[model samples]
Target: MKKLLLSILSIISLNVFAQPDVKFNITSDWGTGYCANINITPDQGYDDWEMVIKAPGGINSLWGANSVPIGGGEYKITPSPWKIPIATPFEIGFCGGGSSSDIEIISQSFTPTVTEVISEEIWIGENSSAYLNTGKEYYMVGINKDEPEASLHVGTNTSATSTSIVIETEGSDNAEINFQSGTGVSELNFQNGDLSDISSLTFSKNDNGATMSFYDKINSEEVIKVVDGSLYSREVVVQTDAFPDYVFSSDYNLASLSEVEASIDSLGHLPGVPAAEQVEEEGMSLSQITTIQMEKIEELTLYLIQQQKEIEALKKELNNLKK
Candidate 1:
């Protein structure tokens, strides 16, 4: 809820002829309607004082003054003789049909006299509305709330369809919503874009030792988490560039059994394979390791085929020699 206070001040000097000191103060405004006070104080006193106001939405009721619609959103006001004396400063109050922003003082008639001055002040009393000021620096938007703990407090109890806050963006463009800490150094971002690859919603947190965790319905444990730039989950699936079926192509260079044995003896590992110590130090990716393993299996199959052909040739030569 928002409150708008409109105060129009006018000052007059008692020693010389000057403009009439008239002030308009909007004391209470509750969005759809408002109540205001018009205080008139001239340098001198007059028996009869009449003022006219222009209120586009019309005045519903008034006190301390007599009011009549002159024409075209303008009203003439005069001091109610029954309420106060004529020689002193007087105040007029009115309740208007619309917002306080619409009320304006159009004209007034008065004569000057030497009289006591009235100090200017505003009185904001209790009102039956959601907009309330509990204390200094405290504005509350709720029903039957006397005290608010925060600077701007909002409370509501309503149907299931009620929404507290909503922010949206329109048009084809990238959008981002950010939440930052009090230090202003750490932040979390929710982002979206127009392209297919970028159109998906992304959540990111930038900070030291930052961790984002998800929980089950019971919240007894963390089901998934991202900590220190790594992800931990019960299960994960990875997509790679392609499978290792290209190892079976005729253009692939397949090492013979002797060459593979020699390379393994010298390097203490299989040919084209990472060392055990290196893998332990810098880990390995599932996609890369899976492709490498599949390529080795395909090479083993080619070696078996070549060995079978040579075995068949030797068996034939032995049979011919026996004959």
Candidate 2:
């Protein structure tokens, strides 16, 4: 696309250079017709400048000049009779019927030499810029660029080390790009200032119902993700109030195996653990679950120690009876 636009500008410039006296600039062009400014630079000290215009539909209206039908889809154009000699090189504004593509300057009579004009197209070259306006909003094509793709297209291949584009907003205001749809809208925002005086980046998906995931490039699998407002990761670490090591204390209450069995029978779950229905309804916290599991393991260890002591005491009593 860059090459194509450059080629087009080159063609327009070459055509203008073909006739050196006239510099044509298209002012505005609608589909059916166009208006233009034709800059005529005549030879030095010659103010009586006239040119022959050849168009498919012919010239309908002309200003800053006089026109006479010279036949063969052409108009013999000269300065208006009352229009005094203002400058050596002057400009003429004209409106013609049909597309600007069919208009051209066949000859001129500043000194019997001819010149040419332009078609309704963007003119981009060295030191030249063009803009297009569909309605009230204006769209510019080039800014310090030989050829540009369109509005908002920035940067080029160069050796200079500098940022291509920079955008700044007022203090305490967020600069955001809004993504809108029929159902809802999402925004990627750069929150700049607040009471905390810190900057942050935020992405809100609204109710788009799409999850964001991060993948491991080497493993080619998702390692972290967000789904339905929750975060998931392959590994996690949680901080809790305390661990189950306190169960080993001498004053700790240890339940007997029969007591634990009775509680399970009556409660339909472990004594200190949440029931399945409860966990399903109001999800489980990782820190709470970890502490509970460790506590159950410690209780089981205590039960094993008590049973070993009973077995030892019974063995001594049986030995005494044998004696």
Candidate 3:
């Protein structure tokens, strides 16, 4: 009976995020609509792919190939926060699969069909979003044709280190990130990525520095981990010798906008207050949440154990009957 109950709970929990909607054929709460999620309705070849990320009046696009299949099909991506989907200042994959060598966008705030960013990106109308901080890095997966470089200046004002962390688990011993030291702020962005593909991630921070990490390519939520004291650490995403299934598409509430805007001059976030914010109130620690989850797991384990005992007793009764 306990095992049966556990199985039922597990099935119900899977729908917390990745619920399939047949109309869009996309797996997710998609609780909110998309900025623009489109694939090639035309003839698309292996060498045709373009994704655009526009913020306010600014536009940026990455070009690539073999991004999407030729025909139409439903796909699940790491939970992407449409615009500023993650902690750092980075845009998720555009996922606009077509036979176009050029990809751009405008800041007009509502351009759905146009592949490039126009002067006024239609996606971002009048929203007063913030920009990427001084040193945080964003992600871009799939078609790596146009890997854009950051026009960042890491010097006297603030320190910055930018690098791309790809989870090609098949060729590496580990898929992890470790930020040793620094002051102002440090962050990591996983644009077009997936957590399953990554076996583990080891995150650490020292002193008064704060690290804002976003794995947009992960098919879940944007995890903004903070560390204020002298010691902070996390287990790295683990990856064995096999290539695991990666689905990117999750829910994310922005971390902090004001501070982010003041820090990253390049990153641009949504206008209104994010529905979910990760700001420290009077008294709240991530440890407490972890403890709660641990307790729940413990309860589940205990329940399962009791059920196992019941099963054993049932077997014994059956044996006696036979005798």
- lDDT values for all models: 0.67, 0.67, 0.34
106-135 in candidate 3: lDDT tens per residue?
111221211221111223224433232212
Q: 2 or 3: which has the higher lDDT?
A: 2
User: Cα RMSD (Å) between model 1 and the true structure?
Assistant: 18.1
After superposing candidate 2 on the true structure, give the runs of residues whose Cα lies further than 4 Å from its correct spot. 1-211, 215-222, 226-232
User: How many clashing pairs per prediction, in order?
Assistant: 3, 0, 53
RMSD of 3: 33.8
Off by over 4 Å in 1: 1-211, 214-231, 234-239, 304-323
Model 2 pairs whose backbones collide: none
Candidate 3 stretches greater than 4 Å from native: 1-284
Better of 1 and 2 by TM-score: 2
**What's model 2's lDDT at 188?**
29
| Candidate 3 global TM-score | 0.17
Local accuracy of candidate 2 as per-residue lDDT tens digits, 97-137: 88988888898755221111132333454535353332325
Q: Using Cα atoms with residue i matched to residue i, what is each candidate's TM-score against the true structure? A: 0.34, 0.37, 0.17
lDDT of 1 at 122: 29
